[model samples]
Structures are given as C-alpha cells and as structure tokens.
Target chain A: MSYHTLQHLTVRLLFDEKFVKFVYEDPDSALLGLDLSKEEKAQLLAIDSRAWSYDSLRRLRTMRSLVEEFKASTTLVLAETRQLAFLDKFFSSPQFHDSIQKRGSMGLAFAEYLSEKFRQKELKTPQLADVLRLESLMARCRREFQKIRVTPLPKTLKDDLRIKFVPGADVGAFQANTVLTIQKIEKYLFEVNLMPAMVLCDDAPRLMDLPAVETKKKSYLMCVPAANGVSLIDIEKSDYLVLIEARSSLTIHQAIERAMASGITKSIAQEIIARALEEQTLHLV
Target chain B: MTKFFDKIAKIPRLGVGISGEFGSANKGIEACLLQENYPELVHFFEYGGDLDRGLDEHVRRWASTGLPTTYHFLDINIEERIDLTSDWLVETIEMAKEINATWLCGDAGRWHFGRRERGHQMLMPPILCMDSVLESVDNIRQIQEQSALCCLPENPPSVVYLGEMHILEYFAEIAERADCGILLDCAHLAIFQHSRNLAPLTGFDNFPFERVIEMHIAGGVLKETNGYQYIDDDHSPEPLESTWQILKYVIERAKNLRAIVYECEHNAAEECLDNFIKLNEMFPCKIETPKLTVK
Candidate 1:
C-alpha cells in the first residue's frame, strides 16, 4: 500500500479494537495485507490500544451524543443503562455498519436506525422509536431548511418543498391514540393537539423543554418539517395528505384543488393552508 | 498583504490566553478569563456548523473579550492529509477575519485516520517522514493562500514516530519551507520529548524557535499502555510542571514568540483560565496576552 494508506492503517490500529484483536490474536490476517516492515508492525503493535479501543472511528461518543440530544425521549425510554448499549448495538449492527458510511451527520444516521427499527418492529419501546424518528427528522429539517434563504415560498412548491422530507414516505403516520400513547410516555418529548381533521404538533415547546403534557389524542399526526426555526411540526390527517401531495409537482393551489376534489370545501382547505403556513408546516408554493 | 508575523511582531510582548471553543457561555468558563486576575487573548478550537448561522454571534462572543485570537484547526493534520479540501477553510477564515484573528493555526502532525465518507475502523499510522514535513509545508502554503489569512503550523503530540528525522528538526525545516510561523503546542512538545527518550529539554537549541508565532500551553495525562507512554490530550486542564518548564525554556530562547494558548479542550473553561494565574506565578510575566483555539 501507499504511505498514506499505511499511515491510515497505523492510526486505525490506534482506534479500532477489532483490528487490534485480529492483529494480536490471528497474527494471520496482517494489517490490510500491507507490505509492513518489521519495524512498522512493531510500532503498530506497541500502541496503548486500551485507551482508544472503545472509541471506534470516534462514533460511539458521537452517536451517543446525538441520541442524547435529539432523541431525549428515546434516551429516557432506553433509560441511562441502555443508552450506550443501544448506540453500541446500533454501531455494530447493519443499520449502523451499512449507513454509518455517511460521515457528515451522525444524528441523521442514528435517526435512520431508529426509524428503520420502528418500521421493522424491532424496537423494545416502540413508541420511543417514533419519538427518536421525529426528533431526528426535526434536526435534519432545521438544518436543511436553514440553507433555503428564502422568505416567500418558491414558485414551484411541489417540486422543491423548501423542506426535503415528505409525510408518509420519510415520516410515519399514526392514529391519534397511538401517537398519544407514545406522547404519554413522555408528553414533554412531543405535544399532541386536537385540530380539525388532524392533531397539530405545531407551536409546541422545543424538545429540550419536554414539559409535562396531557396525553390527549385527536385524529392523526404526520411529522412534517416546519420550513424554518429548525423546528419539526406534525400536521393532522387530511391536511397532512394535502401537504404531502403539495410537496411534489403540484402547486399550493393545485394541492388545495386535490383536497377540494376529495370532498373538502375551499374554505376548509384555505383554513388548513393558512394554519400550515402559520405553523411553518408548509412553505409558500 | 502584510504577513501576520509582521503585524504580531508589532505587539512586541509575550501573550497569554486559552482555547475559546467551549460550547456555551453558561459553562462557567468565560467568567474565568473575564475576571480581573488574568489578562487573556481568546483562541478558539472551533466554531461549530461552519460559518452557517451564528457566525455573527460567535464572532461577537470572541470579540467581546476584546482579546486577540489565533484561530487554529487542530483536526486536519497537515502532515497526513495532503489531500485536504479548502471549502471549510473558506468559511473558517472568513469568520476569523471577522473576529480579527491574529493568525490561523493548525498542526504539523496528522490527527484523523481517514476520510469521513468512508466508515473506516482504523486510524492512519502516524506519518513521521521528511515527505510529511514537505506535505505540511505545502498544506500551509495552500491554506494561507486560500484563506487570505496568515497561517501558522503547530507541532502535534504523537504516540508513534514514523520517520528517521527528528520531530524538532522536522518542525524547523517545514516552517522555513512554508514561509509561515509556528504555533508551538508545548504539551505536544513534552510528549515528543518523552517519546524520543531525550532528557527533559536536553537538546532544545536545535529546533526553530524564531518561527513560532504562537505557543499552545496545556497538559495531558501521560498514559502508559502496553509498555508505551502516550500523552492522552484529554485530562488535566493545567499545563504539567514539566510542560511549564518547556514553555519557560521556549520563552527564554525564542525571538519571535507572540502568544501563549492554554488548550484545555476537555477541561472546564474556568480551570483553563486559572492556568494563566499559575502560569504567571511560575514564569513571572513571561506570558501576557496573545492569540488562538483548536478544533
């Protein structure tokens, strides 16, 4: 291997426990089969691995931090003991191993893992998975939305929703009580509200507040990103569908047309659209 | 543009400061520097999220101290990652310019293992060759040119020495090659001293002292694992007694010293600020107020 590659491997030896174990135990599988000199191998072997052995690409701490920050409710649900365990398991599992390749945002990766676990019915506290997914997406939405330095909505709101996530595709939809059941676990983690044809999570306290809340559920919630404030807002059902359809090739007016076709009056559609805009649930199209 | 060294040379006094990259003002660290007991120039280890939002807020936070700064990037090991990108540097230097940073500093050693996009489980073995020195020099030139700011290269502490050349001499030659100053992290120097098995500050005359535009003073626990001693740059907020001696030695010897930074990335901010008080008692006005931070 080239010198850069060799240097990389040596530093890798410093951090990776699995690589060190293989090198010390197997002695068969060399360091990436590199043409390491005896002195080089000797240097690699001489490191104090125990200090850095647990860090592994420095993600255990990083992912753990993200889980602590974004998925505070999930963190509470997992309790203190399982926090590291979940992160370690996630790190070692395919969910972490396969997707951890995207190095820029560890929060997004951890969120994806929770979302996938929720989708696959693999979570122990399934409701916590929902909260984790919501928290993660909120963080992502806030970050993505900030880059779109526009006050008014784009002319083509359907093609570029200003926000990248969709309701049903990126976020899961749940009945009012199911969400309320999840929220009841930690009402402060999320706010459940009763809105016309939907439950609104807009104008709720930030996840950091996790205030005491009542477990009142309405019709439904679709976790959609508010186009600003790095906030995540969930909208109610039929209205959620309108925003979902509007996130594509349809304009705001077109989306309202679709909602009107689905037995909704123009006034109700206008009210929902106004509420969506007011809550930052949907940007102008 | 007048080189940063030229401007800082005008300051004409030994300076004292600590890493300003602590997460928030509520951490109780900012109060330490602001206290009347210490005169400080702030240095940032990093400003998170690039120059995204909060650029003005971050710049104002550092500028509020009205202390001079040496904004340093400790992550990109110029020696190792010759292929480092310039995009982030653009935003970082822009922020530094806004903060009126005296110098933009980084390390001569490599810190990261591999590229971020790949999920690598290993770190690149430390590259200690002469080419690494050359690579660092080139990295300095490219960064300085792109950032439109004066760049200083600091010597990083290492667990493994991978080249035949001595670390001190390598630092000296590279500073001369890069046409920039050096940010001497004294804690790193102590580790290098131990790793080389040299008597404490035994051959200090050989390295390039004049090139050091900034000095990073901090301490780490000397961790022994498997018969090897590595400086874990995590614990111990104050510079160790030995590191203090080296700092004094550098202060006595160097001609072009400007700032001394107390890097306590893991330690509390108040503790880092307290270091200046101890530094003053030990060195007796050797450090006043100078520039920088780490990332």
Candidate 2:
C-alpha cells in the first residue's frame, strides 16, 4: 500500500470516522460493504458496547501489547461490550481474540499507561530543577518521535478562521489579509478543526528567525507562538493573513501570549482586533 | 510527611510562584523578590509543548541566586513533545550536578489529556510502570548516580507519582519491594477520590508507611464536565475545601510523612504557600524536616 494510503487508513481506523460515517450515512449500503457473512454482520451489529469494559492500560508493556493486537487485525470491528460477552456464542469465531484485544482499545491502553507512569511513587526525591530538565528532555523526545501531517487552509479563509479563536473575536478585514504574506501561521483552530494548518506547510519560514527586511512602511512584527516549534514574526502590514507551518498546535493561552510577546501593541489586543475587523466587514458588506 | 493541604492552609510564608518555562517571566520574579516575605523556593515549570529553551538558562537563573529552591520537571509536558529515555536521565543528572540541586521531582510516565491532542493517538512513550519506577528509583539511588555532586543523605530526596488513589497500594508494594521512599501529593489523592466517602490517601495503609518522605500541598478544585469530575488541575488558585480536609485527615492518619511543599501558581500559589509556612510553625514535629547533607 502507498504510504499516503496507509496514513489515511490509520486515521480512519484510529478515529472510527470512516466506519461511523458508513454506519450512519447508509446502513444497507454499509452492510453491503462488510466482507463478513450476513450472520456475522448481524451478530456483530447486535452486540452491546457497554457489556465489556476492559481495564485501562497504564504501563508501556501493556500498551504495547494492545498496539500489537490492533496492528494484527485485518478487518477490526470495535465489538460492543455485550458482543464481547457473547464470545461464547461464537466459540470457534476467528474474531474472538481480536474482540478481546479490541476491548482494551487504544484510548484505554494509552490513557492507562500514562496514568500509571504519572502515578508511580519515587524512591529518591529529585530537585525540582532536575525534574523539570528531565521533563523538558522527555517532552522533546516525544514530539520528535511522533509523526504528523500539516495542511494549509484556503488562502482567503485561513486568517478569518484563525482570528475566531483569538479570544476577543475576529480580526479586521485588513488584518485578515495579512495572512497572505504569512511565512508561518500557528493558530488553535487548526487543532480543534482537525484540519492541518499552514504551520505544517513545507515552505513556511521560521517566524522567530526572520531576516531583517527593509520596508518603506511601518509594519507589525507579529509574534505567533508555535506550541511544538518556534514562534513567528510578521513584518508585512499590507497583508492581513500570514501563514505558519507548525510541528503541532499551540495551547489557546500560549498562542495569545506568543502573539503579544511578538510585539503586538497593546492597542491591538484581542478586543481591539475584533472591533476593527467588525467595522471593516460592516463597511465592505 | 506532613499532610500538604493543611500546611498550605495553615502557613502564609511558604507560598511560591511557578512559571511554565524558565525565564519566560524573569521580570515577574524580580517583582516577586521585592516582597519582604518572599518564598525561598520558586519552581520554573517547563514541558514539551513549551518553546525550546535550554534548561541550563533556567537552572542558571535560579542557581545564580544562592537561595534554596526547586526546579520541577513538569515531565508530562515534555513527555508530550520528546523522545525521552535513559539519555534524558544522563542529561538531567548532569544538569543537577551543575546546579548543585538538592532534589529533582518529575512525573512517573503519565499524560494529561488536556484541551488539545498532539498525535498521541499514534505514538506515546512507554508507560511508567511499578517496575519502571522501581528501576529508575534504584538507578537514582546508587551513590554513583551523581559522582559529581555531593548531596546529603538526610535529605536523600523522594520520587513522586501523581496518579490514582487505588494505585497507591500497588506503588507501596513496589516501594516495599524496592526499599525506597515516596513523595505523596495530597491534592492528587483527593482528585482520585471515588464514590466511597473514604479518604483519598486510604490506600497508604497498604504501603510501608515509614517510607513516605515528603508531601505536597496545593489548592485544587474538582472540575466537572458532562457530569464527570477529576482532580490535579494546576490552574486552580486557592486550596479547595475538600483538598484541605483530605490533608488534615492524612496528617491525622499517616505516621511516616515528612516535609510538606506547598505547590501553587500565580498569586494564589503564593497565598497557599504562606498558609503552608504557618502550618509548619504551628505544627513543627508533625511536618518533620529530614536532615541530610549535600556536599
């Protein structure tokens, strides 16, 4: 399979998006697509999800076991808890082990593993400085190892959407246009909407390490925070939109603080930006 | 082993403030230092989601001043963004050597599912298991763990696990098996309180109670969403009523508890720490200080 297809399949399976859409969008059509025998489909669909609540995974070894199970399944179906209880009904069923493994879903396994690690007691008390340093190192390692995709928005709509999450409200029409010249954009909307942002774009520049450009007009050097990477700087006043490619999304407050620290005048605080945008939209409409 | 919440409510001078990243707000620290009753310990918090700044700078700023302090490895944040492992251990110990730190506190291997997702749906670090904790504790326990620094044995320090209540029994069993100590945070226990009106630290009855070496106090409020609730939100300002109540209860019950550290953030953290100091003064023996020398 193509790597692209594999990634797409992974997302579809991880989130159950494709399966959910198929079930709700067209039950008969979905049933037709299932490779299982008619009896199997009936048995699978009739299973209750609440009957079998598997224990959560709180350790890496256990989580790894769960991951291995998921990777092995070809046509994995999340068996309902009752369906799990009915395993005896299909004693010779091929999906029995898979069903048991599915009981300890990825979420359950990962959350449990994290909980165990976070909760374990320490023998030797570490200095807070040392602990923080370890925490920083671990955090970097996690980010660097995890792979992800970055997608940009339509040029015209990116800024408008980004401004909506700025807390104060929307940005002015002029500020929204500033996104066009954006070499980097890091906004919270990208994460929430589940659509990759320009911050993940291949060509976006590092917002923090911009070259000094000689411009005729006074421009705003916007500092946008990249939660997983560097902060951004915008020097173009003509364009309202600036695009940022990111390794990951920034927390809501972190993004705002990053923007302010980037030299956004207090005059352009969230509220002011929203008000200006509203006035501009009114004039244009 | 003083119960952390009571100390926090009872003392007023023990409060300290924490910033997410080191040096993100030095100006704020300068302002804080201006206060007469400023706390001796200030935590510079950083995680994976934060900007990449070397820990050296934060350690330098804190160490440059000869004040006794702590630097918390808000490891959860770092776990979210890094490929953490034994290498991280070497670097952290080296950094500790450089700073001459008395103690180092970090997460066991837990992840906080906050407002956003960082692709953990794909890959996450190996969970910190009882065995993992014991192994790490044993590694740090070795005298050669840091041949460069001379830290005292009296304050041998502690390893803390910020996790569920029931898991305490398992942890205690592991600790007993390993002959190591633990730093118990009262607020975390309260967060794990279940439908049983039993105290959050009830599980400590199963552990080698004598091995508990430190306690943490903080104001924590239960947050409810979709009719479910949990504890350990650092953003909380004042210590919650339940948190303090649990602390007092733990103090009454536990025998091996030691130094109580008041953990909080912003102005509320200061206020909480102040209450902790007063508790220490009011009830000194209950919150015993371990006298270990660091060379």
Best by TM-score: 1
Shift in Å, residue B169, candidate 2: 1.2
Worst 10 residues of 2 chain B by lDDT: B150-159
lDDT of 1 by residue, A198-248 (tens): 323355443332323334543444444443244334555667655556555
- Give the alpha-carbon lDDT of every model: 0.56, 0.35
Please write out the lDDT profile of model 2 over residues B1-295, one tens digit for every residue. Answer: 3232332233222222243344533423332342224433432222111112345364455556543343344333222222234444565566554555444444333332221223232221112234343443454344223433211111111111221224466446434543444555556556545322456556655555555544565666544433434343353556666666756765665564545555443343344555645545533532123467999
Shift in Å, residue A18, candidate 1? 4.1
Model 2, CA-based lDDT:
0.35
Q: What does candidate 2's lDDT look like per residue over A18-137, in tens digits?
A: 343454456577445334444434433342322111112222333344333222110011111212222122212223212222221232333333223324531111111222222232
